[model samples]
Target: MESQELEFHTAEEDAGLRLDVWLTEKLSDVTRSFVQKLIEDKHVLVDGSAVKSGFKLKKGMTVRVRIPEPVSAELKPQDIPLDVVYEDADIIVINKQKDMVVHPAAGNWDGTLVNALLNHCGDSLSDINGVIRPGIVHRIDKDTSGLLVVAKNNAAHLRLSDMLKRHEIVRTYEAIVDGVIREESGRIDAPIGRHPTNRLKMAVTFRNAKEAITHYTVVRRYPSHTWVRLKLETGRTHQIRVHMAYIGHPVTGDPLYGKKCSLMDTGGQVLHARFLEFMHPTTGQFMHFEAPLPDYFTRLVDLLESRSSGG
Candidate 1:
């Protein structure tokens, strides 16, 4: 497959930013993890020389990235059923299940939400995100089940992208954290970036970080766990998980940022994208959809509540 090349020149305002972070923001469709992969494979260059993902940018430096075509050209449609919340000519809101990768990446090249959308929506999905991520507007973690909207066309894709950037979209999530948060409600305003050493995980760090805010209200308190509802002010990679872990209450069963001695295991994290609110990209009408807590999540909550009450 032929690769595509894109170039960027660092401006005064871009100086001091990490290469992977800057390139990810510029690409818009790809993730920082993918960008870092490109850097590792020598597909990224600064002033025509390969550089590390964390290379600090200097004003006037020219950065070039080579985007390789997806592994498979003819992506097949899988006959997987989607728990669709809402569907229209322009968008599809899905209550994605846990263990389902949102898009194909690296080890996950099939059996993704995109493949399923290909089967359900067929040729109606948007191609603005290229071949791999057609119709995908945003993504939650594979282990994090939730509601996400997919665009069916280019016009819808553009408008929805704009709405996301402007924070016009509202995404509310419910998570079981490993602590009893005494406060009824609180806000976490911190910058999230790649962990200094882990590289695979995100952390609340000022270095090469982006602004992330999460507002959470304690729904219920257990002896060892707390149920909380959280809303995102900005969507950064693993923002909610990182912020929660930073505040000493990682989401229960989260393999990456969770506590080792978890109260219970629910296959993955006990987080669900429960509510989504946004304006219809094409219709100019208000739109809102909800996905109730998945059975697994509710079952865990029930067990936790029962245990807290000595049941």
Candidate 2:
């Protein structure tokens, strides 16, 4: 793989933003974690000086970034079954199951959505998401189950990514939170950045964080929990989980952001990407697809229904 030297001039509007945060806003295709990796690798420099992700930007500062091509792993096509929701010549949408990593990474080198796409689409998927993620346009976390769309070609990928950046693509999820939400609806408009102490986690920060918005409605209230439907105005990694946790109602079974498993009873985070709506890349028609709540979510509903009915 080769590296490209890229220079980005900060816009006047982007003045006073943190370097890493500014870069993340500019480069929406690549993830924040990947950008942070580049920064830690000394692949990014502000005015030719190596700095941390917290380095604040000044107007007219020329930011140089060395983006190396993702290392191509020898990923063979796997015959994993996919819960495909919709498909056309331009894009394919799938109901991704929980615990399934979207792309090949450190420990998980197979059974990824890429491997399945390679098998299902043959060689038709786009290479825009790098070698590891051949067709993926967006991603949900490993523990978050939901609908995701993959582009079949570069044109589709570019169009879909552009729509996402403009917040034209609507993504919604349903999550079982730890506490009952007293309000019928609410919004979380916090800026999210990497954790100041833990590099692996993300948190809401007054500085160095990107603008995030989450709108949620309480669908069902339990004695100790609430099943909330979430609509994302901005898609950040762990956006729903992090925002919910920040608002004092972490997703039930979320180990990273919430208290221990003793506080809740579920396999993992009870969050599901339930619906996706966007314009068709080729046809220009509005499209919407939904993945039914998984079995575990159904089980929770059954239990909650019983309790709510005074069973």
Candidate 3:
């Protein structure tokens, strides 16, 4: 229950950067607004004195940060079932099923993976991602079923996050698309941003978008659908789904991007985070994980292959 502290020193290259901006940049998982709140609450001090969020940084200035213990009392742990793939002192890899929310949010404050992890790991989970997302490093969409690694401690969390930012963590997904991809493989390099008209959706657009790239190779071809494996070079929000849709091969059952009536009745996109490869954050050894497709996915693929084969 002790408050965690972090110290930072500015360099010549960091001169003139805003205090809040520098904090936000240094704390990879934290947002600028949250950093500003820390400044306003007097939890952030520059050179032993509280400073405004807009205070400009100078070379050799020392900045101290205090991270309060998350108000985690509100999060009650329930005995939710978990499909844990791998566990160590520093990390746990989970094979999350479809329709399972990864963390607590607006309408999904309970029955989330976080709640389940709380019950499972007790106080061993990382607190760097704030209260709701403690221990969570990266996230997949709620409807996406697949593998995700959770850090058990702060050191692991920061290292894993850095791996993701550097694209050193290799993530591969399995997906079924709405149409047949004639070519054996292809790549989609486009900028993706929030849909201008619909805030809830993402689109490939030039306006305030980030560079996104997805490379796909055909796994199998059906009459009207294609099974593919996708690798992300840049992991932006909804990068795979948005890029696939942009290339006219929207993931089947993707309510945000797919056709009104998909090839089948999947509750959501039939994409799974099938593979993860990265170095162990603590031990510095290579680690790899894979989660086989859920029952419904393989069953649907089998049925499609059957029909395509005139069975």
Candidate 4:
């Protein structure tokens, strides 16, 4: 179980607004479902009195919330190796390797980023992500290699998550696609949600999907493949892969979305998260970090250059 106390001071303009809406704006990181649960459980109070989601806010009223401890699964910390690129009291930037799962789930309980982080940070990490994912602010897929920023405390987690929502945190990726892309640069703005029949996969669903945007630039091209740099305008699950596949240029060796290729004999698609930039959660300083291309990506580049030169 966990205990938390939150205070919200209402503004004049926010007076008479529903309590749920007020809390949503104040605690932007926690989803509405979570906030509503707090309210329903009588954990949320207006001026020391329990209230419902529809409770009206008063100009000078303060909303206090006390969340009870959550029942979470057991997750033991392991001494897994980590490539820590940056670290401070509030956050850590890791150059995560390919094939390492970012968090624990079914069948992946021990060898995860959370396990490694627990070993690294000891008891200093926050429990905002529950017992399993103590201080995780965001995530990158297991097969995607490169820089990822993790929070160290609840304050830092909330700050970094807010920055992400505001698009202040920037991430860039380099991908090798299966087909030649003629365009020098372009943007793909579409909606993404769970696949209709396949619930495990995400697709560009026309309805009930959230807005997703990706910008791409052709870096180099071979006879049958193209190297591209991608910038995210919105972060959706499997966004880059799904957006590329939607445009008919899925990443090479993308077993889930693209044709299988042995260009560099890599196990997965030739995609890498190359760079990340964001404001520090506590210090408010601008931080930028980059990860060098893995061997397979570099080898693919060499092959492209050699073919371009008729080698």
Candidate 5:
């Protein structure tokens, strides 16, 4: 693989912005931390001179960035168990367990759903997402248990990706959040992007943000907690968690976006992808799948119910 170089001229509106921030806005796929790393490695230059990531840009200043090719590594197969709900020649739907990563990334090199799929499906899985993420069409957070569909071939992958982009695939999630939601149903329409100061977190912002919408309905309400059913109109990263937190009802046990709660000792956010509906890529038939909540989630809900009933 060959390295790619990108050049950009700072516009009047972009002047006085930090170099890394400018680049992050210009390169939507890359992160600010990665841009800073490129600056530290001297791969980013201002007018052919190496500059710090925080250097303020001037109007008409030329910025050049050199992006090295990603190193390709052979993914090893793992014998991790999978709760496969449906399988066919074109795709497979799995009820992913909590705490299980969907694919291998920086710190996680093995024991992911991709690795498990490699062993389970052999070479039948799609390679559209590269070897590191074979057959993976979409992802849920590592701690968020849910249902996901994996493509078995390139054609299937392309169709699924297109359907997801058009918002034709139906995905519904169930979560328990802090505080009682007074509204019977509501929609959160906000743009989401990387947090300006905290790069590790996503926030609702208009700057270089993508449109995200989440529709939620109250399923049940306890004294202090509320269970909600959510449907995504746009699948932005951390959309559900960020939106729920933005509305002041963060998901219970969500360490990143919500306060700590002892009622659910599940070690992660109380969120689950309960239902999925989509058209099969090969057969063109409508398909639907549902996953039952894990014992931990059910138990916590029961506890909340008991408390609400004064038991």
Candidate 6:
């Protein structure tokens, strides 16, 4: 494993941006959390002085970052079943199930989609995201069942990632929210960042936050809940959940962001990634996929309908 060093000189346009936020935007294949860790480890400096992740940048300021090599991941190929929606030589679209983690992380080392892909695709997965997240181009929350596309090789991975960055990929979700949305359709445009006090959760924040947008349309209204379809313009972590919560209509059953509900048995947020549309990485052709709502989500909808009708 080798360490890499990067240097940047802040311009007028980059002024006022937080150090960790700017580095995450400028660096490829790295996350803000990872950059923050580097800062905490004293591997990031501004004008050769070790600074916090929240250090505001100034024009002409020199920033340096030292990225350590990723630790070797002892990932095991699991025989977990996958509901693959579509597959070709370049990519595989999966109708991921609820309660399934996308990739390996601190406490979740096995039974992830990556482990299954390793066994299903063998050595064909792209390594651009390293061993921990090979082939994963994007992710949904563990409780958000939905469609996700996995890249088989580096070329496909880079192209798909670029498409997401340009907002070219279409990702839509269906969510049962806690409140009845008065408007038929709306968009939530807000900046999102890690919560100031709670490092484990994300929130709508202006300081060191990234642009996030979510467009939603009410599909069915109940007395207390609303079924809505949401389209994401930016794929920030917890973007839809945070945005919806910010708008006071948090997704139902979202333990992290919403009040508990007895009408739903869902273990977490009642949000599903139901639609995906993108261009084929190798074929230069358009592709689309739709995943039906899981049993729990459907059951909740039925319950809501019954309650609305006084059944």
Expressed as tens digits, the lDDT of each residue in 130-209 for candidate 3 is: 98899999999877999999999999999999999999999999998888899999988999998785444689999999
Model 4 bad stretches (over 4 Å): 1-73
Candidate 6 Cα lDDT to native: 0.86
lDDT of each: 0.87, 0.83, 0.86, 0.81, 0.87, 0.86
The candidate with the higher lDDT, 3 or 5, is 5
lDDT of 2: 0.83
Give the TM-score comparing model 4 with the true structure, all chains together.
0.75
lDDT of 3 at 236: 89
lDDT of 5 by residue, 104-218 (tens): 7543567778899999999999888887888999999878998999999999999999999999899999999999999999999999998775444799999999999999999
Clash statistics: count for each candidate? 0, 0, 0, 2, 0, 0
The Cα error of candidate 2 at residue 31, in Å, is 21
CA lDDT for candidate 1: 0.87
lDDT of 1 by residue, 1-311 (tens): 46677677788977898998777655533556778999999999999999999999999998877777767646789999899889999999999998788988653577889999999998999999999999999999887898999999999999999999999999999999998899999999999998785544789999999999999999999998999999999999988889999999999877567743345558667889999999999989998888888888888888997898899
- Model 1: ten consecutive residues of lowest lDDT: 259-268
Q: What is the C-alpha RMSD of each candidate to the true structure, in Å?
A: 10.5, 11.3, 14.8, 16.5, 9.3, 11.1
Clashing pairs in 6: none
TM-score of model 5 vs. true structure = 0.77
Each candidate's TM vs. the true structure?
A: 0.77, 0.76, 0.76, 0.75, 0.77, 0.77
Which one wins by TM-score: 1 or 3?
1
**Tens-place lDDT digits, model 4, residues 1-311:** 34655566676877778888667545422445667888998988888898889988779887777766654558888898999999988888999887777887543556788889988999878777778778877787777788889888889998888998998899999999988899999999999998775444689988779999999999888888999999998999889989999999998877556655755666567889999999888888889999999887888788878877889
Candidate 5: list runs displaced more than 4 Å.
1-73
